[model samples]
Target: MREEYEIYEQSLPWILEAGEIIKKRIQEHTEIKRKSSHSDVVTEVDREIESFLVSKISEHFPEHNIVGEENVGNRVSSSPYLWIIDPIDGTSNFINRKKDFAISVAFCERDRGIFGIIYDVMAGKLYRAHTGSGAFLNDVELNAAGTDGSLENELMAINAPWGSMEEMKRWEHFFKLGTQVRGVRNYGATTMELSDLATGVLGGYVQYYVNSWDYAAGRVILEELGYKFSDLNGDAIDRVYCGGILAASESLHQQIVQSLKESSKEIK
Candidate 1:
């Protein structure tokens, strides 16, 4: 476990270096390619950054398994020590020259994550956390204030795509929650949304679809801050293929889940 913590410490600099590279090239002209849909796209910079990160990890930890967004076509072994990388999350935002994108990384052992890092390249802020340790923004530790947990008084980050049928068929309950909350925001980047949640600025976050790399980093950081995490059905998110996720204070989490359940029963 101590060795794992040491490795976690070593990854911080590598991630920061990647963030610098991202900021330097963010404004340069780049080519974009469509992925599953037109809205889901990838830029050349994304591929380059992913390759660089993978290379760095390979050089230092050759035996560890990696699941990177750009190289998902290749199979990753179910090794106990694994790294999940989203070289440039919110690629569309990055392509549009928006400052809402981020670089997200997570290190895991079997089912337990050791640490997570989300670097907001444009904001020059690094959000990170290790198991049992508190979450942090840059060097300052983050503490959940234990206030503003109510939906009517708290802000939430609910990505716009979640309301679309392609991402979720019966997501109307989520839309209803939006109206109940004090304010709702669509940040286009899960890492930023979850990072804000860790800082207690955003009370909650909900998304209908996300991969392991998408939420893995946020999961570790938010958990360290005592944030509640679970699926829409209020199940534990211990598996890699979590169907969906809801993160908030424990009370707010239950409220959202209970609301969804009632809404579903009405539909039935």
Candidate 2:
């Protein structure tokens, strides 16, 4: 366990080092590619950054497992220490030079996330947390705030592509809650959206789909700072690839879940 923690400590410098590499490449002419969907994007920089991170990690900790967003088959090991990497969280924004992308890394043991780091390369912001240690933005610690559950006064972050029948049903419920809240925002980057929630920049974030690499680090950080994280139905979130993540302060999370339950009944 001590050795794992040391490895995690060693991993931080590599994460920041990779972030510098990404920052340098952000301005260069890079090839953009589509993956899974037009909505899902990737870039040559993403692959390069992932490769750089993997090489550094392997050099430092040869036996550890790695699950990188670009390439995963070669480095996966059955070892307890696993590193999850999203070379660029908002590849579209990165490819287009929008400056809202991030590098996300999480260290887990036997499927339990132990430490997480999300580095906003352009903004020079690093959001990180360990399992028992508290969450932090850069060097300062963070604490979750707000108690008024009035939907009209809350702020929300949601994705833009949920207009289908199934999605609309969910949105109607969220919209009802939105009417009660202050407003809704779309950040276009899931890691940043989750970090916004962790840092209290936004009250909550609701997305219909997200993979493990998307929220793995943010989940641990937010939960450490008195925030709540669960699926839309309010079930405890499994640490794998769970879609429909609903994250917010404890009070707001309950309200959002209750509102969704009521809306579910109405739709039925």
Question: Which prediction has the highest lDDT against the true structure?
Answer: 1
Worst 10 residues of 2 by lDDT: 72-81
lDDT (tens digit, per residue) of candidate 2 on 56-140: 8788778888888888333756677777888899888786656888999988886687889999989999999887777888999
TM-scores of the models, in the given order? 0.93, 0.91
Model-by-model lDDT, in order? 0.82, 0.80
Q: Give the candidate number with the greatest TM-score.
A: 1
Error in Å for residue 78 of model 2: 2.6
Q: Model 1 segments beyond 4 Å from truth?
A: 72-75, 145-148, 160-169
Listed per model in order, the count of residue pairs whose N, CA or C atoms clash below 3 Å is 0, 4
Residue 94 in model 1: shift from native, Å? Answer: 0.5
TM-score (C-alpha, index-matched) for candidate 1 = 0.93
